[model samples]
Target: MEKFEFTKPELEETEGILNHLRDTINDTLKPDDELRLREQLMKAIEEGHIQRDVFGLNPVLQALRTAQIAVDEIGLKRDGVLATLLFPLVINGHQTVDDIENKFGTSVAHIIQGLVKIHNLYEKNPIIESENFRNLLISFSEDMRVILIMIADRVNLMRQIRDTEATEAKKEVSEEASYLYAPLAHKLGLYQLKSELEDLSLKYLEHDAYYMIKDALNATKTSRDAYIKSFIGPIEEHLTAAGLKFHMKGRTKSIHSIWQKMKKQKCNFEGIYDLFAIRIILDAPVEKEKMQCWQAYSIVTDMYQPNPKRLRDWLSVPKSNGYESLHITVLGPENKWVEVQIRTNRMDEIAEHGLAAHWRYKGIKSEGGIDEWLANIRSALENNDDLQLMDQFKMDLYEDEVYVFTPKGDLLKFPKGATILDFAYHIHSNIGNTCVGGKINGKAVSLREQLHSGDTVEILTQSNQKPKQDWLNIVKSSKAKAKIRLALKETRAKDGLYAKELLERRFKNKKIEIEESLMSHVIKKLGYKETSDFYKDIAEERLDTNTVIERYVELRDHDSGVRQAESAENFEYESPNEQFTRKNDDVLVIDRNLKGIDYKLAQCCHPIYGDDVFGFVTVSGGITIHRRNCPNAPELRKRFGYRIVKAKWDGKGSSQYAITLRIIGNDDIGIVSNISNIISKEDKLTMRSINIDSHDGLFSGNVVLMIDDNSKLDALIKKLRTVKGVKQIIRI
Candidate 1:
């Protein structure tokens, strides 16, 4: 409404800027705004303050150099902005700039140079780790100007790339900029850069969809613009009529935002109606910003029907990322839903640029400073050794953020995909290792359960319990994943050693000599890829002691065939259960003869006479028998479990007993024939269902038979072992 004017020094700087920007750049600054900025600059200079280099160089001096360079590089068209932005870096750091220029050629600008430096620095330590380091980098900022310039440089590139012929390449650049730079810009409160980068990037990455929506939007633009103008006119009129100083502006949604709505709602372009929005900026004191916003909302809704469900009150508390605005969707004229965002201009700037814009506009507030977030990002970059920092950063920036609560109600934010386990681990490694379970909002939940916002979680821990291997499946944080992996590995190593000691103690108690050489063979025979695996399996109760000992014996014998005879000396079973053997008796006498010379069950199978039996000579406990289908059969076949010695019944008659066959049936009739078919197929032994009374036609029977030893029993039982109804064969 006023004519543009500037002070002497301000006009001088303006002329220099205009000389460079006149033909090339579109000046978005209104005439009045330009004169105001120039006047402010001159006033600040007169008041003995000057814009300084990031290193504190006087702005007047920097401007002078920048002006000269812009004049020298005036003919450079495509990357003119870039060159102007770079002049400072070239002059300030000659050698460094020369090296970069040599490597990338002179075409690269100072802003690009700064970007490359920051990029390389971030690339070097890409993971956002220890927030401390990031804070240290920022808090020690000599001038903070370099970082600001670098950010501006990226924004300019984002804009410049859009106008280039390499549209596809620029699209990729924009996407990356959005993922990394835009968030950074927003985090820093650089709203101008943030909005432009987001809109431009969204345009290229999703062009067709963007334009389709854009066209649909354009079709309604005229009517919608008029409608919004008419809708807001009364509010402006009412505020003006009330003598309240305020600024009202239209807020259009970004393309990326519109596309997200279409994707989320599964809607066509035509389905989207509320594309146009409004923002009400008020001239008010900091304390009155909220009150005025509410007053404005009252004015808006009073004139038009408002959707209660679409009302969002963010003025009470801003986002952790520093976004604040009050949003309301109103049913405007023609029954169309029109959204409005209400904030102070300060709030609007912060919403758009984030922390960077805050720095430019209001400086940093001590309570919510940029150092805090930057420190977090830095910490993530540093502590993440398992992942490349770039990869972690890419994931870190793109991931949706979740907010959890500390025990004291303070917020603990994590990536969206993080789980309770991650939350526990994030608190402390000791807390994580001891964490057994957790309560989400006073309700007990699994550690693997995904966490959500507003969840007040309390981790349950066991003082003695360690992390379980299954935690690997559910943990999502890079830190948690790495810590859990380390803990599991360390625990497994300890368990393996414990298992080895246990086996050693068991052998020592029995006076069984298994040399370390033969021990390795036993470990390998257990199908363990590593000795540690074998030991851990034993400690975990996954491997049986008998199998290990027996394997050791077999390997010992194989290594030296001469040891075959010595097997008898090593094979001694001093069972605490058996007391029938008399003192000084070399072998127990059964039915008047030494039982050692008579029929015996093989210990490998522990088979009874009626069982699919096998027998082996025990070095001390006479002879032991086992079922032919025993788990030890494979090893026995290879070593001595199957070393069946032939013997006959002492003619003292038959030892009629029970031989149990585990029958697993489909709960159907004639399940016995299904079982008996195999027994009948064997033709060597007769089996009767001791338990099955043939009721309901589904029978699970145990066949009983008297036999000499395991001679033909193995073959007969092997055949029965294959029966359709027979799930397992155990000699009882």
Candidate 2:
């Protein structure tokens, strides 16, 4: 760990931060609360707890700065401030939650506990696969205050590390701040803090881009200010003439945002317009906030041509995070498009600091919706099978909201790009679990169909249509993805148990006693990651029970040494289905090999005329041909090594073999008709049987065909692949 020594100037700065923290929390605290517990927190940190962090910064000072950010910058209350101060003590085990709760209160203690859980989960590098990171994200979300404090803490860390010598640590912190916390801050409506975090993160993570944008901003500072003055002067005059009480100002966009626009637009800094936005904060009554905002909007548009496409009306329906603003882009002087944001003073505070400030207002906080969204996030993290889901979930934190209607005309908000399946889950989990498809605007649509704004969606479901594994790919909402995974996991478990029972019955029919350890080895050798996965494949009919039983019997007999060989060069041993041999010619070309050896192609693998084949010497002095990847290949090669012989296709290969091919596609008459037509068109290809079953709009079937040579087989497979909606076609 890199250590930072406390110097004179650093100590002076720490004192100032400490005083600022105390002053910010004084108004929120009771008369005796801060004087009593504040001293206790600092003393505990000094005497029992860690005096310095991994970076050797003074613990008390860092806590004060973190607390100051939470209280002053984030607009968190006394509990949030105190929890930020007390977290270091609890995380270090010097103070317990009970002790803090007795002195500070339940809210403070709860927040402190949450903070400790998160702080303990923090590592220099965190892998999303680990349960720790998943828990870390989900735990803090139960309380929105916790997420705010965490963002504040991250901002404090990012701000403090710029001059530190810990380059690698700085980069990790910067990356997390940029990728994770910035989105979170934006979601919570802390735009000022969010932009600051993004700017600092870019400075550390992408040094060149950060500096280039900054330098270009500095280079154009004079002209940008002049243009802003010219633009704002007219808006200020028009709004005042209309007697709208408002103060207007122009602020440049953050360096990070500017860089993003440059990259997105594929241009240099100068090539990008609208590098800054104008804000008009109105001093208006609560009831007239919207009326005055529009009045001011009309005043501005009267002077400047408003770009109707760029207008965003959030005044009527504020964001879930309590963000209220009217955003529009108007054509100002010089044919330039300038963005303008208009909101009330109260709206401005809520916009800048989020619902934390809205908590003080009457009927302004949208905690219920934000709470439900966070609950969905928490649910998604539990049993998260994919680490990429966490990244997607984080990006989902601030996704643009899409407003759509249900069949009953109820309006619902979803993340943009959410599909019909996601809407089903959004309504109810049972609906989502059994969802097959939907009707959009009274038209039939698949579950994968993306919902558009203003469309009426009525989810179509069936009790028999449970969530399939592919449902995970169809939904865009985190709630839908998480619920699908849970459903699939439960279904897999049930199938695994049922398959185990079936396997036991088959084992009994074979009269084989299954040893637990030996069965484990068998499943491992069969290439299963987990025992459940082995049984699941059986339940899904991906594996044959007869194949498994044969494997078990082979393993049992091998352990008993019933097929022991004296030597590879002289021994001739035979198992039930395999034979042994002595050395012969290096290759077996079927008809040309030995001229007197009779051979039979193995029925297990159904080796065709043109297959990459091999030969096994039989007890009757004949060879059994088998394909290389035959199910029994491993056992044959392992036990009867001396009998193995190299074989390959030769000459015209006019012989025919019966092959079974499994085909699956959409359940359409034309699809099946086209496949049948193609097979009948090919000469020398006879379709013996076509067995198909249709269910849930999909058709799956197997066709046994007598086909000559692998060339013909390859051609048939290619033609079948070209069939529209045919998902898969493979020979069995």
Candidate 3:
């Protein structure tokens, strides 16, 4: 790449950033190391064009400035600082991995390479895909400092997005930041960055909402400031008299959060009352941090009446993201609700910067707390064995979490909507496989029961109660789903082996060698796509033994001197009248008196009772009922005109017809139960079974039902369609 000369203003800005970087790294980096890094960074800058400015700073300078922020604010080490400075060069395609490693030693080069890979992966794949998202995290896992640097980079990007000219591109960046990066930041406990990213994203993605909130805040700034000041006055006096050293500041809710509240509460900006919060940062000794926090809490609550339900004491048990604080919403001056937060200086740092500050302040490696969270993510990525990978990963990312305890008082964390089955799997795969149900707080609950925080759970299991394929649809955790799939696969493999052995033995007794060619023919005749499927069907007794034997014998005979013409003369066929008279327990009884018309539901349209349907007589399968508007209906009506039979529901048949319905909705806890309750409440309807598949917050399922008439079925569907969260319902 050709080097471009820096303009006068660009040069001044670059120098200023470089000076700031030096000041930030003054105490951390060794003299020789600092000199080498400075030289390398200057060389890289000289050899590349200042293509763009990020937040009014040149890209190269912005990277250095970000590195400085990581060092001073986030406490990244020397290697992290060096890597951040060089990452922009690698990302912009101005430098190669080999060039970086040869010039900047192995460690710095490795970090740069990891950052570059993450950047490229984000560019190539949608962030919503679990595989790509997991890969992004895995890349960061290699070097924890890479996460810090990325956070810094995002902070700078969010700061600069307002200057982006292209509306579409800006919106795209905002959405990604809001959905992916912001959540990641929150997970890491980087509350400051998370809030900024969310606010900036909202500014672009929902410009009108953002400005409306912003303007509302500005209009009330004077009054809010006065309220905060008045509210803090008594608390300040109490703390001062008690000999406590502290500083208090008023904080306003972020634009994004305010917008979220409006949407969730279905209220306008004016309806939002607790828009401003008060923070009291105490300079407490390390050993007395907890005690001091409580003392401060007492002082504040004593001055103002506190809402017991609104109190959150993270000081007793910090959040998983390493945030520690005491929060209370109190009745403030003028009878307004004022939110108050109390934390020590150290706790405040961790609350702002998250895990990075936690490590820096504690003087410990950033592994123990964050590693547990990362391990969960890594396991999800490594063990994903199904098509629901994206959904499972997203559930981990976006869902609120609940912490529950075992009978032994051991704490476990799960997603908010996780059921007892998920808790079982979290205990052990064997436990999950054998789980029948469980007790929540000594009260028996179904396996599908959604657990709440602080519940004491005891799983009930039986050796004979093995994991069913349907369990995959019931559990909410990736671990539970993965274990179920593995168990099902193993069971199928064993059954397939037994089936193959049995078939081979039968073939041997018949004086026939089951060659690969013969097996292929058998699979085709059995209407199976794979040999394994054929064996599995046989093992499950889904394929009739006599049918398999007869088909194999006919195939063998035809391969030899015997032909179809010779077999036709010897073949005994049942009369159409005899076949038509065979009773089916769950078949649709076509017209009131037309009881003996043999028919099968057409797979093409899967006609249900409520569907407008007609029967078509076929040469082999007596009659096939299809929905009137089925894709195959028009052709069947035109080509098989004579075979078409006019059919209508008599609405008085005693027998019930099996029908399948497709349902889609927003995934929520107890959604299946809600749907089931609706079906079970109807007097004439019986639900045969249901299978649900969900990912993210969306669920799609198939419900099999037995109904007597089209009108009743239609009424049932109408009731189901009205259920909360139900988006679409149709006969499948």
Candidate 4:
């Protein structure tokens, strides 16, 4: 390949750039590294190319320069390699020189975010993911720079491949370019890169097919030129006569596209006359360009019959990526179907360059409008779940889009097939969660209903509605799903808390001394969102008091014996030898008083002794001890607070304790009677609770029992949570 020779003026510009680079590097680099960088630059100049792209990222070479110097002098962190990638942005600064650093910082922050997104690709390939827009949004949320850098890298690599060795390696790169990178380039509005990527992808993936197409074109070179001339003659004459300034050029579609057309439609070469399209570049104001193009279109249709269905009015509704061109297939001289695309120069540039070119020319707004394109990048950064974040990028940022509308006529672009739930969420998360119904074009609709282009949706939401777990199955957008899941989890927590509070009040009213932590544990066990919610459930008879007491007793039986202190002096904890006794009435009596320490039951695992137990002291929420059998106990032990308390059931006499038992048995007429009779006769307690439910030939009965502490409760639970013919028994 021939090297590009720099003209005198260009060389002067290059010299200025070099001087700027020198000054910036001098200021930014350490003294020792500066000398080494100069040497590297001198060597690079001698070799030509300067080891830099147009953007001047000579990172690997710079690293060598940096490493040759003492690390302490430069004081660069290993991960700070991202800074090198951001250097190009520094030179193009606005206002104060501080703006340089600020933009540099912003760009570096975005680049680091992009790197994080790129790391996500290792977990799942975004191209193959179902939710392209979600994935795209996730990527964008991290940093739009990631997508831009990826585009730049891929383009540079393609150019390199075209002029380098290792054909097989190029082919692999080309295949990836075709399948993933090219489409991305197209979406980004990088027209030149998009075409080059497509051509390169085709060059390798279907070498034989590409060569055949090339050969066909070469063979028809004379006739092809003649055909285009003949075809454009009338249109040109009419436009010239009308005093319109327009440029027309014939463009053959890429080899890959032709191959795809043949494969997809099962057509031969001759059948694809419209494979080569003529582009009419109108020289006019942006507003008048489309009108002039349409008038030209009318003339062309009049001159030759056009395929009406094949005509695409992109000027009216541009692609989400900002590709705008009017396409129409018209009959040619030999009755051949010829395609024509009409657009203004601006539209053409946008069609080629996507969002980057727009940003370069128009500049992004402060609030970051739709054109900002980095909104998705920010979201990816905010996401902590690696897999989900990656998935979000693939779905929201990378996918093809459908432009819909709000009832008020605002354009809402969403991934294709976005559900109404997604639409609601796109408007706002609160709207999505409370959305019980929606309407497309004034028709009431289900939340799961898929949306289409031009659909004007009105979401109907209830003020008091809460998110349901079932919504996770139907909501399309990951944003909506994530939000719903979060809301549901929160609601359950609040409900659990409410239930706990209600149980505590009941204990107080009954003059029954209750462990505050134990009560909280019971509420958490019930999956309530808060202590208040737990109380509400209890007040509404959704929670039984006896079951709560039995659960507390069981928790005492297993975990009442010990507490442990942390070795870290900063972390204050009680020694495991310390013991706390609670009466059956629920009053906590510490046998060994420990200073600045309190214990409570963890709601996560309402620690019933038979269930397994552990204690955690929350700073203000109080100490929460969970049953060892409690699902959350293990997790609470691992993270956050780790204070545990030694406790025992030292309550005197036959103290009645509440315990809930689930009985699963064969559905029968006398099941309730038999269970009630046993409870009434075998125990000294009356029926405090009885709930019978039958499903799939199984009768599951919940029975609340009053027993003498944990030992008797455990024996009864052993008989209940695991009754004969019982599929499963669980303490509620």
Output the TM-score of candidate 2.
0.57
User: lDDT for every model?
Assistant: 0.59, 0.77, 0.74, 0.59
lDDT tens digits, residues 536-618, model 2?
98998777676577667768878988764465556555454543333665788875343667877777778887788789775
Local error of candidate 2 at residue 564 (angstroms): 32
Model 4 C-alpha lDDT versus the unseen true structure: 0.59
Rate residue 292 of model 2 by lDDT. Answer: 97
lDDT of candidate 3 over 1-732, digit per residue (tens): 545556797679778877776675556555677676667556766766345642334676677667766766566666777788777777766678788788767878888878887777867864344345557656766766666677778777767668667677677667778766677677667778888889998888878888989999999999888888878888899999999999999999999888987764556899788798999999999999999989999998888999875688789877666778999988987888888999999999988877567566766533243344444333334543333443444454433777788999998988778999999999998998889999987778899988776578999999988778878778878888899899898888988999988887876776666668876887796668887788887888656444466567667877887853434433343342222211222345566467666776666566655566767765444777777777666555554444555555656567677778999987755789999999999987889899888866678999999887678888888999888678999876
| Residue-level error in angstroms, candidate 1, position 497 | 27
> What C-alpha lDDT, on a 0 to 100 scale, does residue 646 get in candidate 2?
84
Give me the candidate number with maximum TM-score.
3
What is candidate 2's CA lDDT for residue 64? Answer: 72
Model 1: per-residue lDDT, tens digit, 435-540? Answer: 8889877778777777776578889888997998668767877899899999999999899788878998878876888688678767766777788778887888
> Residue 649, candidate 1: how far off, in angstroms?
43
- TM-score (C-alpha) between model 3 and the true structure: 0.58
Say which prediction, candidate 2 or candidate 3, comes out ahead on lDDT: 2
Best by lDDT: 2
**TM-score of each prediction:** 0.42, 0.57, 0.58, 0.41
Error of 2 at 632 (Å): 7.0
